[model samples]
Target: MSARDAPRPRVHVVHAHSEADSFVTAMKNVIVAEFRDTGHQVTVSDLHAKNFNPVASPRDFLERSDASRLVYPLEQRHGYATGTLAADIHEEIEPVLAADLLVFTFPVYWFGAPAILKGWFDRVLLSGVCYGGKRVYGRGGLAGKRAFSAFSLGAKEGMFGADGIHGELVTGMMRHLFQGTMGYVGLDVVQPFGGYNVPYIAQDKREGLLDELRAVVRNLDDRPVLAVPDLDDFSEKLLPLHENPAVS
Candidate 1:
């Protein structure tokens, strides 16, 4: 069905950028505005502005499973089950849990996402709530959801690729995010939108990128999706269930 004829999505944007006036923020704003204009419900978590605590520590759990020792993942299970996660983490998780589409906005630093955004993956994707034991990949809690990323970087697009100076961006440089984190937890990962050479490029070129980004967001659901693991073809020991089993 066409986007106009389809049901509106619940979009949750996690914006990670230090400067208030940065291009990262602009991309985040544009993505959010486009979704809202299309009658989608949009929720934003501006990490820097909110002073989100990115560090994962014992303090995250208001009531630990083992008060004597701190096991972060174990405690995550406990916290989520008991509704004892820290106020800030819980607040951000609400929108994430409610979202049909999760849009991550940040600038690539050191060929990776900023530390704050990385920390979001660590802290918010609770072991029990999102994934645990056999509940991962295609069987994960968020199996039906989708994730999209819109990031700005200083380098040109040519600098990345299989043989480029920086290698691949989505499946290569940030494979951990695309596959391990997002896809691992069962979100169908979308091929990301990159604002390449923004800092060194001309204003006209930057505007062109923004226009491209807006179109991406407007036609967000139609974007290409990356393949992730499908557990139905795997045994409990993670072996192929069939000789012809496909590995995504």
Candidate 2:
């Protein structure tokens, strides 16, 4: 289709940052502005601002399969099948279901995602809804959709390389976030954009990072989706076949 005649994508940004004026928040704002300016619709789930309940407890299910004991995955499957999930969970799922592009923005904490964002995956990406059993990875529920991570870290850029103390950035932190969670759910994940040494960067450099963030947001569709192994690539035992070796 011609560029103008093409359908505009629905972008959903899940922002997880405690401080409203933080670098992570600024990144999210840049994404929103870029997408909106480019004629795409955008929805943001500001987790901290909403005071999202990060804990996945028995309260998540309205009618528990077993009231005496709490088995999270089983309860998640049951709730999804029966439409008995908590109101909050349902609220989170709505935007995701409607989105064509999903983006997660946060500040890396202690070499990992913020606790709240981690909980977001635990709760929002429930069984039988986002993923389950054979319906995972390349065959996941959100297969046709796209997602990405844009995060900032306190550590310097040089520390994330292969020989650096932090190890390879992509295969390290980004892998845990993008490949593990987002890709597992069948969303074609894009390579993450990291704003390294965010806390100590100069204003000029920070502004440059902001510009880069805007560029990424504006060209979301142009980015390549990271390849992930499909269900067919696995043997009956769920192990990878040599022909289509699984990505670590």
Candidate 3:
């Protein structure tokens, strides 16, 4: 390829659910095809289909040197797994480091990411490379890239809103995980694209979601930074105070 043809932006689509026929997986396929159709250099990491090792084993932990201990507990376990994952994990991280944008696709289980995707984060986002020490500012390793989720939630939409049992927007609940983890590592989180009530959603609504997802992908090149708040200054700048009952 010529130099002009060689520098296209790379996109990595990480799919975390298990079943091929599952709604989340199907949604991922839709996303991959859309990204490809746009002519971006795309890569896929199908975590469940690839049988990714979700647990950090004892040997994995022991592989760490003393200096690595100060890093995230998960970071110390790199290159410790045997059999297939010895290669799989390495392959997963390659595209991650190379990609200009990453789209995480998964089903929200128990109000959070599926265990496997979380494990991917635990394993792939490490200290020195992704975060820690004097690098608390955006100067950390992951500063320039972008990361965000396009998730399907199984719960009813109303249950995730204010005054409901869950009492928070799903994204707000997850701000710390992405903002603290990926954000710490330097990925600006683009606004997430989500669909709620998956099991009960109608065929038409599902199609509409797909259309919206494609729109998001089509506009990916233009996404804004969407920078997160600093943790120390977070409560002061963002938190809301309680109103007195006697005020009115």
Candidate 4:
């Protein structure tokens, strides 16, 4: 089938903004609209609006394996196998499992994802289902999917670079999210689209930023993909080809 005629992706957007009318939230709306307009199916999980719990604790499991003490990963494993994960976690995972594309929308908080979004990762990306052991990076359980980030920052774009004052926004400040978490889980990472100086930018510029994001969602397939380790370059046991080169 022609590229245009091919089926569009099923998109799952995890939005982290708290304000309903904020520009960051507007960017999320644009993503939903563009995907839907292009014949894609879109689902959204508005973290703050849903009052999603960002804390991961014994409460995450409906029934703990050990009532006396909580071993998080073990409980997560038990939870997935026993269908005991909390209701909200299951609800969020459903869309993540069904989606072809995952979009993260948020305002940068302390050069990282908002606490809630980080909690989503902690609670939703189930250990057994999304990853474990050798199932990480290229071999991760979520390998077939793609992930994109649309974020806004209070600082200017130029301040972020390998040598810039902030020193590498995506690869540095936010690396924990895009790389450590998303890439570690095997999603094909896309170059991020950031709205810089968001708090200080004028109204027209904010609108233009939305327009840029609109085009980004519309042409998501054309966006550059970021680099991550491929299992092919490693051994069957996740070690490097040269005597298990992967850093232990």
**Candidate whose lDDT is highest:** 4
Which residue runs does candidate 3 get wrong by more than 4 Å? 1-6, 61-86, 161-164, 222-225, 230-248
- As for candidate 1, its clashing pairs are none
Off by over 4 Å in 2: 1-7, 243-248
Please give, for residues 1-248, the per-residue lDDT of candidate 3 as tens digits.
88676888788988998889887887888878987887778888888878888765433343444443434343343433322224555677778889988889998876678899888887776555666554543666677888867899877778866676777753467666666667777788787777888889898998888888888877866765556655444332334323333322
- Tell me how far the alpha carbon of residue 126 in candidate 2 is from the true structure, in angstroms, after superposition: 0.9
Least accurate 10 contiguous residues by lDDT in model 4: 239-248
Report the CA-based lDDT of candidate 3 relative to the real structure. 0.71
Q: Report residue 13 deviation for candidate 1 (angstroms).
A: 0.6
lDDT of 4 by residue, 1-248 (tens): 89988877799999999998998899999998888888898999999999999999888888888999888888988998998999898899999999999999999888888899989999998887888988999888899999999999999978978778989988888888888899998899999999999889899999999999998877888999888877777776676786646554
Rank by lDDT, highest first.
Answer: 4, 1, 2, 3
Instruction: Report residue 153 deviation for candidate 3 (angstroms).
Output: 0.8
Q: Compared with the true structure, what per-residue lDDT tens digits does model 2 show for residues 7-48?
A: 788999999998988889999999888889889889999999
TM-score of 1: 0.92
lDDT of each: 0.88, 0.87, 0.71, 0.89
User: Considering only N, C-alpha and C atoms within 3 Å, which residue pairs clash in candidate 2?
Assistant: none
lDDT, model 3, position 73: 43
